[model samples]
Target: MTLLADRHGRTFPYLRLSLTEACNYRCSYCLPDGWRADGGPRFLDADEVRRLVSAFAGLGMWKIRLTGGEPSLRKDLTAIIATVAATPGVRKIALTTNGCRLSRHLPRWRAAGLTALNVSLDSLDRERFRAITGRDRHDDVLAGVDQALAMGFDAVKLNAVLLRGINDDELPRWLDWLRDRPLALRFIELMRTGDNGEYFERHHLGADVIEDRLRAAGWTPCPRAPDAGPAREYSHPDYAGRIGLIAPYSKDFCVGCNRLRVTARGDLRLCLFGDFGVPLRPLLREDGQRDELMQRIRALLGHKAAGHFLHEGKTGITPHLASVGG
Candidate 1:
């Protein structure tokens, strides 16, 4: 089997597939106003998804993460998960959501073949969570996370966008929670997109703060998994849970890039912040085009850049995190 390698020598074993661009939360840094733009009222159907995953799986991709504005919003998500799980060579099926409906739908999702999960939980403090995500469902989300831990998933991660004064001060609460819980919590550095420049300037906190604190407190770096996300994970002897930092602004941040993204509309985004997308939706329309689908994806690797240009303040065409499944 052929491995998905780019010109820069980075091999991709993971794929972040956006199922839809419809989110219910109005997160401060992400969709402050909720989803407002393109990429869809019409997302790729289950059959197209099956074909897409089959193509990727045949090319050495084993991990497929279903992401979205909020992936749970899709009613057919279970079918999508099952389709991916049934694909040959696909070993892991994961999903990232806002967690509003996690408790209501998790068991069904797990049974449908979801192997891992990530929930967008910006804060543990209810009011702060409401302030950040514009949703008063923190309690519900936390309960769902607790339930997820109870279920024996291969991995369960919590994602929080690191904001300067907003949720940055809430790490103590997370650390306290993580001391006993076995979940993996990751703090992602706020990224600049087509929009949110002013907000990014106001709330973009360096991820080094969390890293420094973790290092000082004696959290040892954990070996990265072959299909791990971009986060640098660390563990402490005293805590059952682990902490990870996804600092996109840090020097050489993209050097460890291992995953590629595809929008809900079926456009393949080589870089999350890539200025352009090579449309793959047309190729996904038919099973007979699997070779062409893989060919288009494979050929694009030769043009993949060494790294993203976020350091220069170029946010690319991404108007919001939800739009591209961030």
Candidate 2:
């Protein structure tokens, strides 16, 4: 019962837990322009989350990632980290944030057993940053990066979602910025999700373009041991860690995808591109339903698709990425 293999025969050992669906910045790639403030989400209670992590660990999952509209926004983040760290089989605990709130939580987070950090940053220019994230905190994010490194976080990844007309031309510049730094620079393909579909059509740049630009900039693709996710990692000939191109949209990583997600509200999602998800909260709340839920999870994984159809013009979740924990 601890190990559940998917239809593709891949067993998932990682789980992405979305702490909340709330966010401060209305990024062009996530939320659209003229978005309303609809704060009507049922976030999982802290205790419930603890129980879920414990159960997942009992089920053979060892790597856990706390993500969100902004996971750093969760009030009990440190407590959640501590609880998951105590889980039996759990080996890795990480968080992905927009970098707007990372610096403030670095010291405390590291002390609580959180191991890795992935920061979302699109552009380096002040005006462009503001235009992209609908905020003027580019400097704040940069400082946050410095603060995270100074605090000794194991790995600090800078996530850049590349859009074609928007920031594609700045690829080399971004690479140069991280050339001397040890942090991993991840370039995410502009995914078709949320209200930001407009940018998908305008800013979608495949990994090939990114790779070509990196080579033209005199950077070599340092080979990496195979990794999970869509990003094909490459590094400067002499750079420390490496840069990764996550082409989730342009090039789906579903074939080797061995990860599943449980939304803050308790929905079990098999794939990021899949539309339907079974609600696990009801089962988790009932002891008698525990076995039933596990069976459902197994069945779901058995039906998992080989990969997502991102290149076939699929935009937005049948339920939107925000609802699906993108």
Candidate 3:
């Protein structure tokens, strides 16, 4: 199989697939204005998703991550996960969720060959959690985290968006929480995206500040495991797990980007901050012409930019994070 490489010679082996634009919680940073809980946007059906995964896997892609405004909202998520996991070239199948509904489905997903999970938990305080997620589901999320750890998946990660004057002060608390667990806690910097310019200006906190705080608390830098993603991992001498930072603005983490994003509607985003993408839903619905579909996908990969333009003054893309699959 031919590898999917762009003009800059970076090969993409990972795919972030958005299952739907619908979400239950209205996170302050993700969906500050609130969103429709009942109906918002439609998504590709299980079969269509399977076909796309097969096509990507045929091109040497091995990792597949199912993302969404909230992936757990989908009724057929387990079937989707099973389909992708059964695909020949796919080696890992993971999901990123708010974790509100993950507890009930953990066993089924694990049995279906799920390799990892990334749960979103922004704060440890109950009131502060409600303030951040715009919902009082902190206990539900924590329950899901407990379930994930109890199940013993290959890897389970917790993602937190760091905002100044918000959950930023809870960094030490988060580290303390991670001290006993085997999970990896990652703090992500806020990106100035689409309609979030004002929000970003008010809340964005650099990862450097988070690192200094960790250093002061006695956390030591450590080498990242070979299979690790974008998070710059660190550890403490006394802790059982590690802490990570994902600083997209203060640092250029795109030097070796090897992933592509496909929205639920089938638009392939080569770069997270770029507006250009190629629509593949219509093409996938065509007659059984797998070779032709593969050719088009390869051609599109060539157009991916060497790096995003966020560092050069571009605020963000036109689509919001919810629609863009986070």
Candidate with the greatest lDDT versus the true structure: 1
Candidate 2 vs candidate 3: the lDDT winner is 3
Least lDDT summed over 10 consecutive residues: which range in candidate 2? Answer: 221-230
Tens-place lDDT digits, model 3, residues 1-326: 66788888777788999998878887888787766544643578887798888888989988999999888888889889999999999988989998988778888988888989999998999999899888998898899898899898888899999989888889768767888998899999988777787888899888999898888888888785433667888888788778899888755588768788898888888878886777888767754856777788888887777677776658445456787677
Alpha-carbon shift of residue 319 in model 1 (angstroms):
0.8
User: Tens digits of per-residue lDDT for model 2 on 17-92?
Assistant: 9888777877877764523436765688877787777767767788888888788778889998988888888888
Top-TM-score candidate index: 1
Q: What ranking of all candidate models by TM-score puts the best one first?
A: 1, 3, 2
Q: Candidate 3: list runs displaced more than 4 Å.
A: 37-41, 216-218, 225-227, 313-318
TM-score of each candidate? Answer: 0.98, 0.90, 0.94
Candidate with more favorable, higher lDDT: 1 or 3 = 1
- Local distance difference test scores for all models: 0.90, 0.75, 0.83
Q: In angstroms, give how far residue 313 of model 3 lies from its true place.
A: 4.1
| RMSD per model, one decimal | 1.2, 2.5, 2.0
